[model samples]
Target: MINRAEGAYLGAVRAFQNPMLDLLHKRHAPLVVSVLSACFTAERPNVSVADAHTQIGDALDQLRAAGYDESLPIGTSRDLCRQWADAGWLMRQVVDDVEVYRLSAHAVDALDVAGRAGGARARVSQSRVRTMLDAVERLAQDADPDALVRMARLDAEIRRLQQELDRIQRTGAVEEVDDEQLLEEAENLLHLARELPADFARVAESIKSMQRDVVTALRQDERPTGEVLREYLERAQHVMEATSEGRAFAGALRLIGDPQRLDGLSNQLDVVLRHRFTGRLAPQQRTELREIGHRIEQGLDLVFTTQREASYVITAQVRNHDPLRDRQVDDLLRDVMTGLQTWMPESRRGQSVDPLRRLPVAEVDHLRQTAGDLRPAQPPAPLEDRDDAVVDVTSDEARAWGGPHYAELDRHLVTLADGRSIVDVAVAFNAAPEALRRPVDLLGLLELADNQGMEETDELAFVDAVRPDGTRRRLAFGGVTTRMKEAVDE
Candidate 1:
């Protein structure tokens, strides 16, 4: 027979691995996956069977438009819904005499995975580094109860900052990142932003589960009320405090609620969006990001509500039994006994104890000396006299290299006949008055092909062009037709 440990291990592994993943990967299941993704990935609380069916049909249509010819019958969609309900990916309930589906915990986890997998790959960025540093500082302060431990961490951070400053001074300045690097970092930020909501949702679900377990235990357990309350309180504290995931979840909730952090995150995202190297996001990505943000906010609110409800329930239960009050009395007696044990002898009681005597004096002195030695030295003063001289340029000289004035070219091109080839326009431009034929004016003519109303035709023509330097250049002009308005008779 298999051992209990082996069985437990297998069970844990099974719980971690979603069977729906295999079903999603099966052939002919792409449409089903898309339907589930669209329906569950959204922030809606529930979807009726009719609505889900309609959504599936719409998804199938989209798939067909995207060149997938496989036909999905209505029966197949219904069967898929039934399968998901059976597999625990969806919970079905009758609402207003109509069946509706809400995503099960497994479904939510599956969707979270799908979202991250489909999103842009995350990259390390300066903002993320700063956030990490802030988290480390906060954790050090919160997790370490000893004052000396906190002092040591703070000292180390200070030294690290000093070293960074020294490195920057030696290097003159930080180098600018190239476009490729910026794009990678932006994509990474987007990935993390998308995942944030999903993470919050999972945390909220865990809290809800804990709440449910507490309620169930209170209702079903036959133990003494005080003992049960104590057990529940201990478990709740352990889940919300002792565990790393719990701590992280709590930290994330606090960060989410922090206005300054929210503003900083918003500013960072705005910068990423406005970056020259960051191209336009796909429609789906934009939608996903917006949905993620909305869902995260909603999930956080729900978590707070659940917590309040749990607290209310616990308070009511404790009040009914008065166990906590009795327990407090017991704790008081225990504390009194512990204090008696710690009471000094009559001879020693008269002597005053120094708080400093608690610490290792030699170690403290060594730390002080080491900290003094690690302090950064002051920089040398600059030279009194410098050979560099500043030069000023006249306005005309500055304007000379400004390159290309395109207003005249734009006005002339916009008034041209609808079907005129770019070659014909070029000839007309060349034959125009000298005042309109300035190199800067012709520069605007080249930009017409890129204009909004300009449509390229199959024909191509070679044209002679004059550069801003007055040099002759051969240019290939793709025949383009401009949309010109017809004059209406008065």
Candidate 2:
């Protein structure tokens, strides 16, 4: 409702409550609406009260044409009649059985205050006899008495709310309400949150605990080496994602109270899902860790890398293929048996660790006897004890000592490659026939390095292991560097 002037509003209410106004509405309201709508829409000069319904319809049509599409659900005639009557702003009459509508006195009273010329009420005087005329003629009232009654009820509601508006305007401070005070309820909620139940408090404690654990894990240098460090980093990354999820849950708690569904299972589940480091380890993972740790503890020197000047920063657990694993196990077993060879002579073969260092006394004596033992061959040659590690035999020696198979090896027709090129063939050689080509790749050269360890020996032998003829490429001793402090045997 538009804010009507104070006088107009009070007058409308007075008119509405007045019993006379009720009679007045019963008489003229519809006719007045029809005429007013007609005149407001009256683009033309002549309009009859008898033509009020048509005029009202024309006005509604004009409104439609003007793009004001307010829905007039029922016929304009009856709706206009009902609205004007309800407002007590018009009057109705039947002249010659033809319904005509015009304005009423009370409507004039209110509209005069609303700045209307004469609300809807008007009267005509003819010479001597004067008569009252009003705008109440446009009713087809017999059509639906119930509809009119309903509109009357709605009109009463309108009057009631209008009066309520008037009362508010008179003294209520509702319009200028303060926003800060409005947020008082939320502040009360915050106070309640401070006094949280035991459940939420427990959750907060657990979150703090988790924060401490992950933070501590990040702070510590628990990973002793690169591989171990990488594994630790992987675990950290996994748990960090878990922490992100936990944080999400924490945020979600702000929306939905403490999570009750998983609350009981939270602590243990968090350890498994959120903690990065496990205090305990499985037997096998523990064994691997210990072995790798020992390898580290042996000094970073044990890791021999291919790039001579490059540091062995990366320790790849050699790809665990079955053939490789089997070979490693067999080598280990062979080493064990070799170490106990003298006691367990059932071992057909006895391997040497550095033949130059661990010389056989008997072989030393024999070499002494051969040269009258003069100077006693102080660095006695490996007369009998030699490793199957470094086989260094030239063509003539290969023929004389290695026999017919020696020539076959030169062309690779015979694949007796392991340690073949490094060790003197007369002292040591591989007897395995590569009939199926399995030993092709891992055939390390038999390097005769002056160094005392197999790692250096292997590294040196590996660097300079080859027969110039390229027959056994496995003896990759094609390297050409001079004998340095730790020079590999060529």
* TM-score, one value per model: 0.46, 0.17
Error of 1 at 91 (Å): 4.8
TM-score of 2: 0.17
> Could you tell me how far off, in angstroms, the CA of residue 208 lies in candidate 2 after the best superposition?
88
Residue-wise C-alpha lDDT for candidate 2, range 1-490, written one tens digit per residue: 6556987988889867863355435544343434463453212212345476576777667766887555433456657656766664554534344555544434433322332233322222231121112112123334446887768867998999998899899988456424343233223322222222222222322333443443333334344334444554454334323543334334443433445533533453343333233224334333333232222222122111111111111212222224456567768898878777755664334454444666455634333336455464457567676588666676654533332343343333123334343333211233334321222222321222222223223332332222424445344443221122222354
Model 1 superposed RMSD (Cα): 34.8
lDDT over C-alpha atoms for residue 29 of model 1: 50
